[model samples]
Target: MDTSQHSMHNLFEQLGLPSSEHDVEQFIRTHRLFSQDIRLDKATFWTESQAEFLREAFEEDSDWCEVVDELDSRLRS
Candidate 1:
């Protein structure tokens, strides 16, 4: 097996986060959302869509929970 095939996904698994298409993409999005209403410790530049996504994720705070829960459920299955 290619050990690095899903390195990003695996890292996310370690953090209990789902793999994003690109870390930079998520990085950019997360801070942009943060910038909308708050000055973040880490600054970023992302499009409005990115900001929307990060805002949604922050509001729901469920993507990671679901990913972890899904992994557990899969293990059970």
Candidate 2:
């Protein structure tokens, strides 16, 4: 079982993004989800693989879900 701590920084790394705190904040700030109807995984800015990872993370309710949900919340703001 994977025991590594899951956080926004780690989640960004999992998504193959820059995992720094500032980078995550900048990404969320610039990429607000304009429509409530659009899911995080369906956002156009993500590459296909990133989208798939997000989709699966939520669908499986895996360890990554909380962090992913956090990201979703931030983007929605």
Candidate 3:
């Protein structure tokens, strides 16, 4: 299992955001977990494509899964 953190560019790209460190940080700060136990995949902030990417990454347990899980937990918290 590759436990290393992926690049911010990859994460941002997958999320359909600009691939920049500042943007990534700003995005994380701006978006919080929705109330009512909503999943990250259901977050309103994401575009349809971004949401689908997250859902697929999680369901498929792909290489991006760990990062997706991390993002999910962080946003929820």
Name the top TM-score candidate: 2
Estimate, for each residue in 1-77, the C-alpha lDDT of model 3 and write its tens digit: 77766765788886667878787777778887768478788888888998898899889988888778877776766
Sorted by lDDT (best first), the order is 2, 3, 1
lDDT of each: 0.41, 0.93, 0.79
| Reference-based lDDT, residue 8, model 2 | 95
Q: What lDDT tens digits, residue by residue, belong to model 1 across residues 1-77?
A: 43343333653545445466576246335433322344221224434554444455445753443443333233233
TM-score of each: 0.30, 0.95, 0.79
Q: Name the 10 consecutive residues with the lowest summed lDDT in model 1.
A: 34-43
The TM-score of candidate 1 is 0.30
User: Which of candidates 1 and 3 is the stronger one according to lDDT?
Assistant: 3
Name the runs in model 2 displaced over 4 angstroms: none
Q: Rank the models by TM-score, top first.
A: 2, 3, 1
- Clash totals in order: 0, 0, 0
- Quick one: best lDDT, which candidate? 2
